[model samples]
Target: MSRQSIVTAGVLDAALVLLFAAIGRLSHGETLAGLGVTAWPFLGGLIIGWLLLRAWRHPLSVVWTGLGIWIATVAGGLLLRLAGGQGVQLSFAIVTTIVLGIFLLGWRAIAALVRRTSRKRMPAPV
Candidate 1:
């Protein structure tokens, strides 16, 4: 619920979307100049995801925020792309889901693991 956590979650999720686009562009030998085209649709979905799920409350929670964003992004992005006459192949959907799942949820999973480890190492409270 803190301001910093909300900001961090937003930044992390947005950066993952950008990273997904940038890395895909690199893999396809496309220039980064086209990142806007690649990133905007997903970013749009990210906005919707946040709004629909009230993700700001727990934006880094894997089950709620992360999964919600992934599903919303894929569905929203496909709709946007379809409206724009852009390609929305099945393969793209599958790839987007897998990659976004990793990027969005992966960090939180790692953080949770680390927190668990740290807690185990701490002495019992007096």
Candidate 2:
């Protein structure tokens, strides 16, 4: 992948993690002012995922990079939250897994589909 694609994937992953935190906080009647407190664990997990998977090399691979990152983001986030003395209920973990899986992997799936369709539309080489 190009440098730009790698950077974009990383940024988008972070943004999705933040969005997950923000939604959870808002649903609990928490203020946006506490967003950093809510987001940091999952963001940390996202970084860990990127590093562990060397995700930049295949940033858009839905099965490879995306699956590993999603797993890391959920598992690492829950572990970090536990370490930080934050609530880490089973239901919360389940929700986090489902949501982050959707957020991290969903985009890559869409992008893959788009690339496939666009390739089919391109004219044959001379």
lDDT of 2 by residue, 29-113 (tens): 9999999998998999899999999998899999999999999888888899999999898999999999999999999999999
User: What's the lDDT for all of these models?
Assistant: 0.86, 0.93
lDDT of 1 by residue, 24-118 (tens): 88999999999999888888988888899999888768887778888898788778778877898888888988898888789878867887899
Q: List ranges where model 1 is wrong by over 4 Å.
A: none
Tell me the spans in candidate 2 whose CA falls farther than 4 Å from its real position: none
Which model scores highest in lDDT?
2
Q: What TM-score goes with each of the models?
A: 0.92, 0.98
Residue pairs with backbone overlap in model 1: none
Residue 34 lDDT in candidate 1: 91
